[model samples]
Every structure is written in structure tokens, then in C-alpha cells.
Target: MRGDVLVVHETEKPPESWAAAVLLTEHPDPSADAPPWQEEAIRLLRDRWAGPGRLVVFAGGRRGFPSAAPEHAEGWASDWRGTALAHSDVVICRSPGGGCPAGVAGWGAGHDSGRIVLRVPARPAAGERPEPGGPEVADAVTAALAHLGTGAERTGVQRQVPLPIWRTDSFQRWYGAQRAAGNTLLAARPVWSLRIGADRRLVFYWALHAVVHVTAEDRVKDNEVVISRPDIATAVLYVPGATIDDTEIVLVREFRTAASTPDGFVHELPGGSSMRTTDPRSLVACEVREETGLHLDPGRFRAHGSRQLTAPMSAHHAHLFSAEITPEELEVIRGLADVPQGVAAESERTWPEIATFRRIRTERLVDWATLGLIVQALTDRGHPLP
Candidate 1:
């Protein structure tokens, strides 16, 4: 995103009451000493804001940058030396009175694009200060962009909750791939989008808003936002014994906040998102090993089928698979119940759970969907039970 920047001084008065503003094309010498506020502004300009757009500074009375005099003018001038306001697409400034000043509405009068006023704390300790280049500022800028319908094709209303900014490259790459595959409902442009949550290197949840062109004469506004996530790979590890009572299904017990169970833990098949591997079979095997600490070949995983977990809320599917194991392998997996498994860096922890097939099928210890997967895998493998 090409971001325009406006640096405003801390004023008790509102923005419209300001008498002068200055447009700066060149940054002041880095070696020159500056006051605290100027120092913070310079940091934001250098690290946070990106521009081929205008850089404007605003203040009241005679106050201005140390190197430049205030251009006493009405509203924002169209020109200051060689700099022009016409090139600006967005305006960004800090909230000097703890909240955005009401007069900021006047600043938006001349521009069709969005304006963002970063919030500041009402009272900070004598030495403590908020980081202008931190995640909070990034969130504010992205929210402003989404609300203003900034994207390849601005369509419909870009509805989105304030969320962490997706790394620009990541969002662009994903969007480009979707367009190339013609999977975005013949979208003309993005109305808005945001990443709801994510892992270290991947997004777990996402939302999008767009406009679709179904025909030459018809333009349909896509709903406010459509949410989705990456598909999951899951598998049931079956261990055979001499009788039905002895037979077991290997599962993992992990703390999932989304789980509605009593303990907020899910006791289900070993499965997870494709984080460590992109190959579906490999992902199944990888999740099994990470969650159960039981090594198994990817080739051992038999793909039964895949289905959408939630049709209305997400477009992602769950790829179902199963693996057969020897009784000795079951013992080895059982031994891992006391030992924590899963990717530690990602804050995951799981314990192996080996339950009798009969009990798991009748007791409702797991979700109905998981029970369905188990039954489907067993029946497909020619081990149908009564």
C-alpha cells in the first residue's frame, strides 16, 4: 500500500483552528538534534510511513519544523514549493488530545481517500511512551485502508473488524493466486479483507468483502464479509486386537478454546492445519507424529475423502484419512500419554489418548463428526463393525 503521511504537532486546540501547515519533500538531517516530539515524528516517518505521496506537517501559530517556516494558509494549500497535495491518497496523523480531534473531518474535505488518526494514551508515566511503529499503529493503518475499500477491485462495503495487519506480500500473493484460479466468484475488486488470527507463518482465519460481476448488466454486492480458513488434514489411527472390546483408536487431547466440552479440550483424531507440510498426506502424517509422538510413514495414511467442516462459515475442507497400526505400536503410543508432544514453538501441547472403539462410538467422548470419520475409515478399510 502506498501510504501518505501527515505529521501534526500536539495541540490542545482542534485541527481546523490551525493557522499554518508545511509540506516537506526532504527529511531533515538525521544527525541534527531534535526535541522529543520531533524525534518521535521522524521515527514514524522513517519506519512506519511509505510514500511517493505528499508529506505534510501541521501546527498552529508560528510553530513549524526547525528547518522550515510555517506557510500561514487556509485549510491545506494545494502547493508548497515543489510538493503537491494532489498526489496524496491517504492522510495519517497522531491524536494529540488523547483522541482524534473532531476537526479532522475538515482535513478529509478535500480528499476522497481515507484519513487515519492514531490514538494516544491519555496519561503516560513521566518516562514511558507508546511505540509509534508498533503493532497497534499497523492495525490502525490497515483498518483505515479496509474501511476505505482499498484493494485491486474496490467492491461492495469492505466490512471488517480491527485486526492485525497481514504482511503486504502475503496478502498480495494469496489474492493473486485466487484470481488466477478464478475462485473468487468472478470478483471485480476487493471491498475489504482482514486476517482474524494466525500462527507463526500462516493465517488460521480470514475474512473478505468484494463485488462480483456475474453479467455485463448485473453487479452484485458480495455480502459484508465471508470468513474462511485453510483446510485441515485429519486421520484416525486404528490398532487391532483379538476382540472388539480390546480394539482401540488413537487420538490426541489438546486444549482448544473453541471446544465446547466441559474442560475446553478436544479428544479427537490426530489432525491439524497444514503448517509443517503442504502435501495433504504428509500433513496428516506430520500432525500425527507431532501430536502423538508416533512415527508413521505418509504412505500408510489411506485417504477416505474430504468434506467441509462448516459450510456457511468457511470454505475450507477437512481431508479424512486412516492408518492401521500393530498392537505393539499402540503400546508405544500409549506410553506418550504422560509426555507432552506437538510443536513447542507454536504453543501446542497434546497427549496421546487410546480409547476402546466400542466406548468411543457409544459414549460421545468426541464430536459426532469425528465419530463419523472413524466409522467411514474403518468401513472403507473393510473392517466394518456392528
Candidate 2:
């Protein structure tokens, strides 16, 4: 089996192939003891293999993949390898905000066709779980080979990260809508992805290495790993008053892990990602109700247009809206201040905060992005802040 791809499980004897050896593991924990075969496999790759060959070790995890950490160097796969392959250069596949079983790619030697290890996603798509001899395993191998370039195997595996969204209905819908709007895709490949939601897994955050043709002369290449959850609906909710000073602004204080605040909490307007809904107004309305317990009418929301939240790193856009509430509604929202709220399954904890518009700006309570949304909403409504 000189040029053939060999797939083996635990304690399986090698088929004497030099092209590519894929070692599959049903063991989920990266901290678990490595089986006897793992050390032997690493030793063979380090000692033998003069020319083109590759070794791919694949494992699965239920809570998350070994390579889904914020920093790839700190990923579980980097230190999981036994003493034999301990110092090998590890490449954690970019899964922004982590995944429930992410993947990593590492090379043992200097050459491209060297020993590699991968942690395949236990849940590849919505409502799917990893099974022995499943198609996801094959997809994982294909992705590894693809990432390894032309030297991994001569089996004609395409030299691109396979789009693994075939079973993801939400991704399919988003892709279809994007394409229908004439944003022609030139060449796209998924780098890493994480599924969101408890009831069903959907591609929530994704990283991609892609090239898309936008216009006749505009071919954009994006290698950023921040490629998921592009469209989000947010609003500048307030109660209109005689002057901006008396205007009451509504914000939710929530613990954001990445926040630099002393309490790891950020105070921002009510907003959320466009999940399970296509209408921006509907999405914001639901988010407002869930976050602040203010059940405002969807018709009350006025679209203030949208802007890219982070253009350089991601395609995510903040769909801006503004809603003016009555004094009675303001009193109702104030009654719920400091109340623990948000979707429990998602581990979201928010406290509704009602502050004067002047106080918010004077104290610099919100980030620049939130400030921009406020300015945009006020400007759009012809009540530009002085």
C-alpha cells in the first residue's frame, strides 16, 4: 500500500503504507493516557519515512475539541501527545470561541508531508454525533489531506478545505441568501467552525480561508478565522424626552468573558445574533424582550441601517435599529433593573440597566461600536446628538 490511504483504529497493525496513515480514536479526552500504539506510531514517523508520507491522528470529544481553545498554542492537542511527540509543531485549527469537539493540524517534521494529529468534531452538523466509521471521519481525513497540500497523497483529494456545511440547514440558508444577492463565491474553504444552540447544533462561529469574487476586478481573499454569525440585529432603545439629558437609555449589563472590565461585564444596548429569524426587526424584538424583559412591538423598531462591526477580521455586521418607548414603558423597564435575565440554556445572564442618555455618554459607559450605533440612530431620526 505504497500510495494508498490507510485508516486504522486502536492497536491495529500498519498496512505497510508510506503515503498516508490515518489513526482514528474513539477516545474523547485529550488528557487521557495515550494507548501503546500512539507512541509507536510517532516513533516510526520520526525515524523512518525518507520521502512523501503523512501520519494523521484523529480523536473526538463531546464537550469540545482539543484544538478549539482561544490560543492555538494552548490547545489540548499541543501537550496531549506523549513524550515521543511532545515537542512537535502543533497547528490548532481556528475555531473562534471554541467548539464542542474542534480539530487541529500539526506537523511532526520540517516537510509538509510529515506526521500530523487532528481532533475531529464529535458533532459535525445539526443533530449529528460522531459514530465509528462515520462519514465525518472521512471528511476529517479529507480535510487533513487537503490542508497538507499536494504531497500528503496521490489519491486526487482536492487542495482546498472541504465546505462541511452540507448537513447544516441554517448555513445553507445563509449561503443561499448571500449567493442570491449576487455576492458570487470564487473559492471558499472552511478553516474551523463551532455549532451553537442546545436543542440543535448549527454553525454559529466559523473561520474560513477563502477567495470571493465581488466585482469584475474585485477578488477578495480572506483568511480570517472570524467568519460566522455575520448578521446581528441591535437597537438603541430609549424613552424620548424634552432634551437628550433627560432621555432614558436602556442597556443590559452582562458578563463577557473577553471583556476588559473589572467585573467582566459589559453594558450595551439590547441585541443578539440573527438566529432562527431572518427579519432584523423580529430578531431585535426577541432580543430586547429576552435581555431586558421589555416586550416592545416589532413595528416600534426603526431601522437605522447596518454597518460592519469588524470589517478587517470578520464579515459580521451590526443591523442598527432605534425604538422609542413611552414613559410608562420606561417605568416598567426600570422595575426590572438588576434582574437576572437572558436565555438560560445559553448561559446568558443579563441585568437590565436604565440610565440617562447624558450619563451614558458622559461616563463613557459603552464601547465605540455602541456609541456609533447611538449616533447613527439619533442622526437617522433627525435628532442628532449635540
Candidate 3:
């Protein structure tokens, strides 16, 4: 992995400055009674910083001087002096407890400083463990070099693609034209559907479930649509006393891949697309039961209201509802688990264990998913806004 280097400045140079590099290399055959710290330090350097460097081992009273053979010590160097030396624009000294001489003669060789000494904790601590890869060490080095004014910082930008929408009639016409044109525009045929609204507005949503390869100047090419504006529906469920505590709400966390969204894990409320049912209240109940094992009665939960979100490239109409649920109901919902089946079988063959469950307080309800719907339901019932 690529990373930056760190440089340190010192006012005065110590006696020994001739060593080009000081590396921690493992002993050919370390004794069982060897000091644990020495062994650990050598291990850390070898495992984490094995890239483009040489190893140097100091001699001890009993161990004598390290066997710096011609092949091993040809390009390697070390100082027995305790004095500080400058390398790669940074100062370094022999660590404490080594058998090297106190001060020794060394030259200021023009050497590139590509190595760093890391202080590792002697014992393991809570929430702390040895890093698995060298990238982490590279990151640390880069950060240190940046702080020392010897490294440059990098910047990156991400773009999101917007979903497309059209009228049902216009979409059908476009689909027929493309089909008659020998389907040359798209690699695979596009799937078109009619999304009708209660207000008599017919929206045509095209979903190309199959992948399509398009040759265009713009990098942001449109992918197949999984959910259309008309097919997209949202419902909010409310429990009267649920918000009393600060950690009651249980939001589902999953990985979602949609236009204008990250491909990482996301937290969302239980909801579905293309709801054919007329009763929004019943839809909320069914969704809650299906996604989260919580059985909610339609009569107990009432539709607060509906909101329509429209942008230049995407539109979604959501229906929000609220219902009261007991602590026992919350427990059941938290415990209910399922292993993904069918197409998702390989992805989640083993059921995911619940990571955590918390009841959120009324004042903190804003942190929960579908906060707008929850607020709407509460406000409709004369609940004062926070």
C-alpha cells in the first residue's frame, strides 16, 4: 500500500549519525529465555514494516554482537552510541536496555529515511489488538509525516447517479419505439410498467433488471431501476409508550444498493415497494410483521399522513402510521431472526445475530429512521413537539 513518510527535526546532532538505517530483525534462533519485549518489538517491525528496509540487531552482553555477516550487513548499518542521529529529516536514538556502546563514531551518510519506530504496548488492553495488515502502519507513517510537514495530504470526491422517471404513456411509447428500432439502444430489453396514482396521475416506471452496457461520454450511466417513484411507498409504525425511553426504537440495518446512495450498510425502517393494497394502515401492519416479527393491529395503529418527495431525478411517496406496542412486543421483535433464503441464500446462509437493541426516548426520536412519520403521528395526537 502507498503511504506518506514522517520527518522529525532536532536542534543538535548526537555523537552517532553514521548508521543509514536501524531495523529490528528476528534472531536466527532466539532462545526460550530471551526478553519478551525485544522479541515483540522485532516481530512488530518484521510483520508490519517489512517493505523496503533493512534489519539491524544490536549485540547484548550475553548474546554478544549480532552476526552482521557480509550478505546481511552489506547495506545495513547500526550505531553502538546512545547519541541521537538525523535520518530522512527525523531524529532517532538507540532504545533503552540495549547492549550497544554509549557513544560511537558514525558518518552522516545521505540516506533516505523510510522507516519509523512504533511504540507498542507491552500488554493487551480492552478494545485493542495487534493490527492485521501493514496498511495500518503505512497510514500511521503518512499521518506522522503530514504532521511533521514532510508529507502531502490527498483528497477524493464521490458522485451519485440520479434515477430517471417518466409518464406511463410516454414510457410506453418510448419502449415501443426502442423495440421497433431493433433494440439497438440498450444491450438488454427494458422492463416497463404503469404506476397509477389515486389522483388519476399515471406515471410510467421503467425497470431494466438486467445489466446493460452503454457507451456514453458521461460516466454516470443509468442502471436498471429496482423501485420506481410510483411503486415506492413508505409506512411508519408508532407505539404510544415506545418513545418514553431513550433506546426503544429498533431500526433494521442492511446493505442497500440504489441510485444516489452508498453501497455500504444502511439503517431503514420496515417498508416495501409497489404496495397494491388501498389501506395504508394495513400495509404498515403487514410490513412491520414481515420485516420485524412484530404483529401490529391495524386498529391500534392509524395512518398519520402521507408525504411526497420529488427531486429532479427521483420521486417517492411515503405513507406514515403509528401504533402502541408493549415492552414484551419489543422483545419479541428483537429476538425474531431469519436467515436470508432463495437468491440471498449464499449471502446470508447463517442467521445474523442481533447486535444490539435500545429504546429511544421521545426527545431523541429524531435519531430514529422515519422520524417525519413518527413526528406527524405524534403531532396529530396533540403531542407537543420537542
Candidate 4:
């Protein structure tokens, strides 16, 4: 992201309207900072800070070290100097105000690419120009700004949400090789996308720094089908029925605010967002243990299709996997079902409410689709469904 500079001053009465004063700066030297999407930032901020004042400070000097501004207070320290050396600098609360603090707030984005971009340099199309990023790119850019605590209201930027993307076989192979070789790619994470809908309707998603192209004919009349997070993993753990003669799996009954279940809790597989944080198999293993206290080896999880549907509203692609249930794992489930989770106050996490669905066949709670997936997986692994 390119460097950014925001200077806010606290004023009294007539200038109290000016308390929301914002000063934007620009450096003449092109290489001094990353290219900025100033136009988009201006439009978004104009709507955000609609007032009697807007000033753009163009540094005719360059980008570099600071020269003392005798006109201003002695202690004033700005992030970007009026020279060609320093990039992405911020100056906040250096001078004193009438009754309030001299500076209310300030924002400075690092020299990355301005927090959002048309495309990342990592995933190379090699001579192929990326599709023209529309408002979606701007939305991501502005959202990244908001996430830096740049707005007046100080809205919380949610980072937990997954950024969605459609990966090619070659790209997946590359990513896998990188991971196996312990080569962490920087161009990943906090996705960026250009979502174009019907009637040229455009909405942006900043999940990762990736892009998806759409032609005009791809638009629908009044309906626009956009998947927020398409690629994910959902797995079912089969365990034993009442007598424990054979093994069965566990299906989670979760009440998600984003998903609408008849009784709030839907019968869904326990899984995690398949990201770099955890390997897909490991994530499934963690989910199984967290939801059912079952400890299964990651290698046991068999992946099937890449188009598993967790919910209709979230029409993203996901992986479906299943594992054989062991008798020892069944005993572990019984042991953890009522185990005390000590205290939920550590990470300020909500105390978990344990629910028991044991003593029931895996097929009893699993939907046909999920049940079918598990059966297929078992058969493919040489263990036919009973």
C-alpha cells in the first residue's frame, strides 16, 4: 500500500465546525511513495466528512526528511516530510489546543499499495492485463482505510471474515508446493476482488489481493449471484450408534447468526476456514476435536468434492471430507462431553454450551447430501458404508 498522511486539528467555536478539519498531503517525487488512489479516497471522504472544509496539501518540495516548519509549533512531527526520503508518515497531537487536544486523530497507511489495489504482483498472469477493477476495488481500499481507524465514528473493521477467491489448479499446486517448502507468500491474505453484477452493478470484496473477471453478458436481469466465500471445508465425523458395536460420526448443531436455521441450530459439519493458518486436514481435525472432543489423525480425513454446499445463502465452493470413527475415539467423546472447560474468561471467549447428540446413528442427524458424501468417502477408501 502507498503511504498516506492525515493531519487533524482541534479548533474552537467557529472553527469548532472545523474541528473535523482534515489535511491531505501529496509528494511530488513519484518513487517517494506508492501510487495512491486519491480520487477514490477523495470521493469516499467527501461523503464521510461532508463539511465546510477540505484541503489537499501538495508538497512541491519532495519526499524525505523533515525541515523545521517555523510557522507551526516547535514539536509538530508529520509522517511524510516535505522531501523525497521519508514515506508514509503521520503527525498527531504535537501542539496544544484551546481546551481539547491539539490533534483529534490521524491516519497513515504504509508503503504497501494503499491497503487495496487493482492486482497483486504475486499471482502473475504474465503479460495479461487484469480486468479493470471497478468500485469494488475502491470499496476495498476505503474499507482498509476504515479498518485503520480513519473514520469519525471509529467503526470496527472485521478481520475474521474470510476473503473469497477461485483458484486454478496450477495456482493451487504452486501454493501447496510453497507451503510444503515452507515458503510463505506475502501476496496472500485480506483478499481483494472486483464483483460486477447485473446492469453493470458492481460491489467490491476485500478478502484477499485477488481478482475475478466478468463479461457484460455474464450479468443477470435483476438477480446478481455473488458468492462471498466460495472455497471452504465442511466435514462429518462418523461414530458408533447406541451400543458402540460399530463407529459413527458427529454432525454439529450450530446456531449461526449469519445462517438461518429453522430452530437457529442447523445440522452442519464441523469445519474451519481453509486458510494458511491451518492445513485443510488439520483444520478438520481441530474442528472435530473442538466440537466433539474427538482426536483423529489429520491423515484420516478424506477429501471428496470441491463444491460442497454448507448453506444456500453462501453459494461458495467448499470441500467435503469424512473420517472413520474408532472405538477409542468414541470413549474420548464420552469423556469430553461433560468435561469442565475450566474458565471461558481467558480470551474473553463466550463460555461454550455443550450439547450431546451421542447414542444416535450418524445417519440419524446427517442430511442426505452429507450422509451420501460420507458413504462415498468410506467406499472410496475401501470401507463401504454399512
**Which candidate gets the maximum TM-score versus the true structure?**
2
TM-score of each: 0.53, 0.55, 0.35, 0.40
lDDT tens digits by residue: candidate 3, 1-386: 42211111122121221112232211222223324344333344334433232322331222322333222211123432212222222222223232222232332221111122332222334587633323433443333233223121211100001011222322334334444744423222224333344521233453433222333332323464433344333444433442332323445555555413343544455655432435666766665665666676778766656554332233345666666567677667656655331124223121212221222332232233356554565667665554
Model 4, span 1-386: residue lDDT tens: 22223322211011111112222332222223322333344445544533233222222223332222324322223423321111111111111111112132221211221221112121226796533334543554344333333322111111111212222222344335434755444222332344333421122332333222223344222222223442556675665344222435555555455445455544556664533445567777766666665667889888876653544343445577877667676566656544532113422111122222332233355455555555565566565344
Alpha-carbon RMSD, each predicted model: 11.5, 13.7, 23.2, 18.4
| Model 2 stretches astray by more than 4 angstroms | 1-189, 197-200, 211-226
Per-residue lDDT of 186 in model 2? 47
lDDT value for model 1: 0.54
Model 1 Cα lDDT, one tens digit per residue, 297-328: 99999998888666566556789999889888
Q: How good is model 3 by TM-score? A: 0.35
Q: Of 3 and 4, which scores higher on lDDT?
A: 4
Please state the error at residue 298 of candidate 2 in Å: 1.2
Model 3, C-alpha of 201: deviation from truth (Å): 21
**Candidate 2 lDDT by residue in tens digits, 42-143:** 334333333355443332222221222232222233333321122222222212222313233222221121224454344445676524334433444455
Off by over 4 Å in 1: 1-202, 209-225, 241-246, 275-277
Q: How many clashes would you count in candidate 2?
A: 3
Best by lDDT: 2
Clashing pairs in model 2? 64-101, 65-101, 65-102
> Would you list the clashing residue pairs of candidate 1?
153-189, 153-190
